[model samples]
Target chain A: MVKKFMALLRMKYIEMFAYQWATLAWSTGAMVQPIITMMVWINIYETEMESFILYFSTLILVERLTAAWDVWDLDRDIREGSFSNYILRPIHPIHWAIAENIIYKGLFLVVLVPAWLVSSFFLPSLQLHLNGWEWMLFISALLLGGGIRFMFSYSCGLLGFWINKVTAVYAMFEGISLFFSGRIAPFSLLPPIMQDISLYLPFRYMIGFPIEVITGSVKGADLGYGFLGAFIWVLIFMGILGFLWHAGLKKNQAVGG
Target chain B: MSIVVDHLNKQFKVHVRQAGWLDAFRSIFKREYQIVEAVNNLSFTIQSGEIVGFLGPNGAGKTTAMKMLAGLLHPTSGAITVEGFIPQEQKAEYKKMMSLVMGQKSQLIWDIPPMETFLVNKAIYEIDDNSFNKTLDELVALLELEPLLNKPTRSLSLGQRMKCELAAALLHRPKVLFLDEPTIGLDVDTQEKVRRFIANYNREHKTTILLTSHYMGDVTALCKRVIIINHGKLLYDGDLDVLTEKLTPYKLLEVHLPTLPNQSWETYGEVDSIEEGKVTLRIPRERIREVSARLLQEFPVHDLNIQDPPMEEVITLAFQEKSHG
Candidate 1:
């Protein structure tokens, strides 16, 4: 099992390096969103004499670091007939996809760490100082967010079993994530009650919860609740993902074999 | 030491359809199902290292049978064992022992060199570096894949890519090779080259090859025994030469006579066609010597030749007979 894991890691790095230029383009796209957010928030702070602007700019920093990867993998695999090749292999192709996500997430951190440095340097308002308990809560939220995001997107991919054209579904998923994940604006900035409503949905837990903790939007009791909410949603999505996997395999036709 | 498929049966739960939009919508709500008996009560056994050709017309269940043997598709009701192990178990050891290649589908990664695909297969098969290199060197030399190895799969011609595909499938040096129309769509020259490669590979590795091909030459060149099926039923299973003898009992006798014979040609054999003063007759295999002697004495024959009916005729006749019965 260790050999398989190590081999998978090696393969993931090799594949990522081969498509390094594509990765660069992707990271650049991700970077542009945060830069645009920072500019807009800085302008908004020009008028409002409040600390909310500090949390808003910090929102940009957190969103830049935590990016979701699902639509691209699912949409491309559906478009190319290459998915057949994946299904034919003895090993479950999901293992490779998981390894690739791990590699991409690790690589994203490289750009993310430097981006954090630059943001804090230029805009001191983007940095948040927290106690040890706060840090623990924030990391836990992020880990739970990863699980929620992976399982939800995987369940979306299994829609391939029923629909031949799944790009529309993926497009909708991406569009919703961009808004609900707080990439457009901080979850707090949505509407008066929208923040409470967002907490009930998994999308907020996937991206918004972690970002909220990092930007110090969550107070002592709220931070604990956010972590708990993320964990519960992760369980829900995990169940959904497991069900979709078994159902998808049963419905598999093995076309053109 | 042997592979056996006992009472093999396969049924596909095909969705039934009516041709209009309403039916299509109704099918979404309630689907009609039909069971297609792809292979029914089929049984065959093959010993180790014996090359058997599976011959059948389209939809004759050859592929369904091959899929069963490869453990890709489950049998509806049957038992299949290869070397004392059930195939559908699909253990890593069982997968390591066999390889499958389909002519219609390719395993090579397009836009990348074949070597990349080879490396991927190496990783999947868990082939050690030393064994991988040795086996790859042997396949490269045998398949003449050296030139095609580095070129992107999309750039290589069909024949070249097929050679690489074969090599890729065999990189693990599988003991049983399920080659489904491996030489399809190749030029005659390339087909012969691939046929020779399969033959040589089998000889060197002592691999058990169960091959399916539309080209009879592919069957004759590499396999001495054939299992002929028509409409999912085995029509004949034995020596290829014996099938020809049993199905077609007559030889085609073409006589290029010096001049037209005024006498009736019934004494020689059944007259099939007489054109341009050349007479072609079909004579029973047993009467060939005597009939030729009598024909020579009676007619001013310039050239007389006797040939067995083409194997294509025998195969067609086998299917025709099965189709009726």
Candidate 2:
């Protein structure tokens, strides 16, 4: 099984390289949003501009690492009857999606790390000063965030089995997540009510909490809460993912080619 | 028995809507649905190493029945067991033992060479390195895929791609194969090549195969026993020759003469066509011997030949009979 999984991962890695230009284009496009947001906020809060640069730069890297777009591929497969190929196989289809996610993140990070380093030199505020323990916690939080976000997106994608078009629904969720997950701005900079709400919601745990951890903005008891929140949300999303997968398989029309 | 399907039925709940803005809008809130019996109370069984042709016209439930058997679609009701495994359960062991190839649906990675897809299937099926290499080599040799395996799937011709598809499906050496229209659009030569490969593979591997195709050549070449279905119902199930004999009561007789005969040819048989020096007639199967002898004695006949009506004609007649009934 491990051999099979490793093969799948390697195959996906090679496939990604085959479309190197597209991967580069997507990575470049992803950086645009965070860079633009950083520029806008740097002008707004002159004194805290350094912190803004650090937060958004980390956000850019984290977003690329945690991103999961299997939903689009799933939607197309369902519509085109390509999903039946996976169904006929002994293997569960999600492994292919997981392999793709890991490959994309691995390749994207290679590009992102260098980009981050170069930008840090140009933008002095983007540098990070973190202790070893903080680095450990940050890495853990980053992985948890990626897991939560991936499951969340995948669960939403499973809606395609029930509905004809899931894009509108996904877009709605993404619209809300942008504000709540700190894609637009850090949770602390938001209104007090939104910040309080983000604390309980899963969105912040997916993106913002990890950034906060790595930036050393979250600490002490608050750091404990962040970890707890991430854990609970991951469990909730994973549970939802399990339910959705079962329900989706049952509902699979297995539309003809 | 390698396969058993008892009272297998599949019904699809299809939404009904008329062509109008109001009806389309109304359907969103209170849509009406009608149950379509795609496969109705179908039942058949095949022994190990037997190749059965699933004969049907468009919308005749052949593909649906095959899909259910392959575990791609759930049957509405009834039981199906292939190799003691209920297909609907889709257990790993069952899936590992069976493979389905739809000619219209490709499993290949279009952007890459077919070898990549084969490797992916190798992992997906979890075949050991030794077995995988051996099976792939055998398949490649059998399908004549040595030259095609390295070429990108998009660049390969349709016939070449289908060969690769077959190779991909068979890499695991599935015990039972469901082939749905495996030669649908190939040229005559390619079709013959595919048929020969399928026959040779079945003989060598003793793979239980259930094939569905509109082309009678495929059925005639590969299947001794055929199950005919029309309108989601079984019309006949027996030896292919027996079905043909039962459905068709007549044979075609063509007579070539040195000169045109003025006498009416109806006395000989039902004249299908009469040309300058040749006359074609549909004669009863029982009278074929008698009719040919009489025609030879009566006409200035240069030559005469008797042939069974085409299989396509027999199948069409069978379907027609069902519709009339």
Q: In angstroms, give how far residue B124 of model 1 lies from its true place.
A: 2.2
lDDT of each model, Cα atoms only? 0.77, 0.87
Q: Which stretches of model 2 miss by more than 4 angstroms?
A: B298-303
Residue B165 error for model 1, in Å? 1.6
TM-score per candidate: 0.82, 0.96
Quote the true-contact fraction of every model: 0.12, 0.58
Question: Which residue pairs clash in candidate 2?
Answer: none
Best by TM-score: 2
What CAPRI class is candidate 1? Answer: acceptable
Candidate 1 C-alpha lDDT tens digits along A45-88: 66542354455444544444445566456555644434544654
